[model samples]
Target: MTEGPDITFVLGTRPEIIKLAPVIRECEDRSLTRSIIHTGQHYDESLDLVFFDQLALPEPTHHLEVGSSTHGRQTGEMIIRIEEILRRERPDTLLVQGDTNSVLAGAIAASKLDIDLGHVEAGLRSDDRTMPEETNRVLTDHASDYLFAPTEQSRARLRSERIPDERIYVTGNTIVDAVEQNRTLAAQRSAVLAEYDLVPGRYCLLTAHRAETIDDEQRFGDLLTGVGRVASHLEREVVYPIHPRAAKSLEAFDLDVPDGIRIVEPQNYLDFLSLEDAASLVLTDSGGVQEEACILGVPSVTLRESTERPETIDVGANRLVGTDPAAIVEGADEMIDRDGEWTNPFGNGTAATQILDTITGAERREVSPK
Candidate 1:
């Protein structure tokens, strides 16, 4: 009757929560002690609380309330708050997912406190350091005690960076786990398609909230123009569920969203999943969307020059079009025409099990004698 190890899961955004839901479920199923720390990086109820309800995830043990700010300020505030929690709770391990500021802060605080740190979705690289997420990914990978890389390609990236092979495990991306667990529920319960009057395979799902895309007025305008062209060409609507930050940027830039593009507010997880499942194609600057689209066997046009999830491209499920209007239109058409026959390279719906096993196994190995 040895005690199971205590683990803390740190997350701050909807994407992180979605991807980590299965892991949390696994912990509960196993009767393992687990705590969640919500950083409140995404503070809105629509973007945050609704996801927890949709995923049936438990309430977080602590919410840091670290809302949006400049990168330095946000990360710094998270580090301070998270470190305080770490000192008090002192869990055996801290697990973080994705490349948000919260991940970076969690890694730093855990490392500083000498706690074992596990980074899910580790070793992804866009190779574009200018992107803040890229920087976070690199730093967190180097600092992590366990690197749960999603693919062999990701593992290779870590090895190239000289991360010790023993510390890295190819556990596959947990997005697969999340999608498999929720898709059936989404289909059964979500009426978003009918509510929006969107016919399956007749609309494009567009999401652009990345700082590199939405924060730049020129880039934002170009993205909308490109999507508008594709919508007109296909005689389809481009359904955009705008992030709150992007909404403010739209007003700030006074960028007129073109015709054929229907703007909508952010959606709950099930609704968004339903929209993605039904869309003819997806066009976005979101890393999560690219992964979800690929998993759902949907075609996607990424609104970026580079992507961390390059496997989507290698498998013919995604094309990067950047912000060029013409390129965007061309890329969308090409993807729309391509067959979604490419295998999902992410994983089977067992990543959360693999992740939990890895964590507990590592702990056992540390305690056992040679």
Candidate 2:
């Protein structure tokens, strides 16, 4: 057994943790030598620590403690800190998921250190460079030695960018794996529905945390107005588990959340899964929420003009209804009336196994040369 450190998984934010939980479990199940590095991008105990317990994941081996800052400052700080950890640990391969600044920094640091880097959820592009995540996705995909695409469309996007075919593998998304693995647990353990007095398939779930949407005062106000209208029209409360950042922006901008929108604190993975699973419709500016809603067979209304997860839209499970109040209401009505029979295009919950197999196989090929 060639055994120093074989692989290091780097992530930050709740979505990264939730999506990566299954992969970490797979590593544990196989007794693979693996380490986790948490960047601390989301330092809130509710958003960060609660998830580790909810998902039953072990504590991260390295905590960078890189709290929030300007985009450039935060990404720069993470690159410096992660590079130091990579140097000290000298793992054979570094793995990063999604397009957060943490992923960008990990990709950059590993590339500079000449370490083999694997990017999970690679090749997703919204084609809108204005979104910070879009830039991160494109840059990390180019920097990565192994690109684990989540779908055939994502792979096609990479080929169009001329990423070498040998470097790309269409591993189904791990979000499906996470959802499938946790749905039953969520139903058994979560009291969110009862706490909120919500009936299954009767309310709309809302999440709006994207920087572009929340940072603009006009856009934020419009989104609130639109969602409020939808709620009034449907005569059902929109249960919004507000992101900390969005909450801050709301207060900073002096915007009042409209009536008919019930705002609550952020939720742990299992609790949030319960909300997503039970909602008749989901409205959000979050990519992960859009994907989850699709996998759960709930119709979703995306509050953005474009989405990297177009697979959801293609399968008729999601609709893009920007921030306009009228569009939001119309889209919500349309989605709510639609049948929830769209087949999930993500996968059959085996993405983590395939990802681990690919990573270990690549490590073996690398060790054979030495």
Q: List lDDT for all candidates, in order.
A: 0.92, 0.90
Clash totals for all models, in order?
A: 0, 0
Against the correct fold, how does model 1 do in TM-score? 0.97
- Write candidate 1's Cα lDDT for 153-194 as tens digits: 999999999888878888899999999999999999999988
Q: Residue-wise lDDT of candidate 2 within 202-250, one digit each (tens)?
A: 8999999998999999999999999999999999899999989899999
Candidate number achieving the greatest TM-score relative to the actual structure = 1
Assess the local accuracy of residue 93 in candidate 1 as a C-alpha lDDT between 0 and 100: 91
- For model 2, the superposed segments whose C-alpha errors exceed 4 Å read 1-5, 362-370
- Candidate 1 local distance difference test against the native: 0.92
CA error at residue 236 for candidate 1, angstroms: 0.7
> Distance from true position, residue 32, model 1, in Å?
0.5
Residue 199 of candidate 1: its Cα lDDT? 90
Which pairs clash in model 1?
Answer: none
TM-score of each: 0.97, 0.96
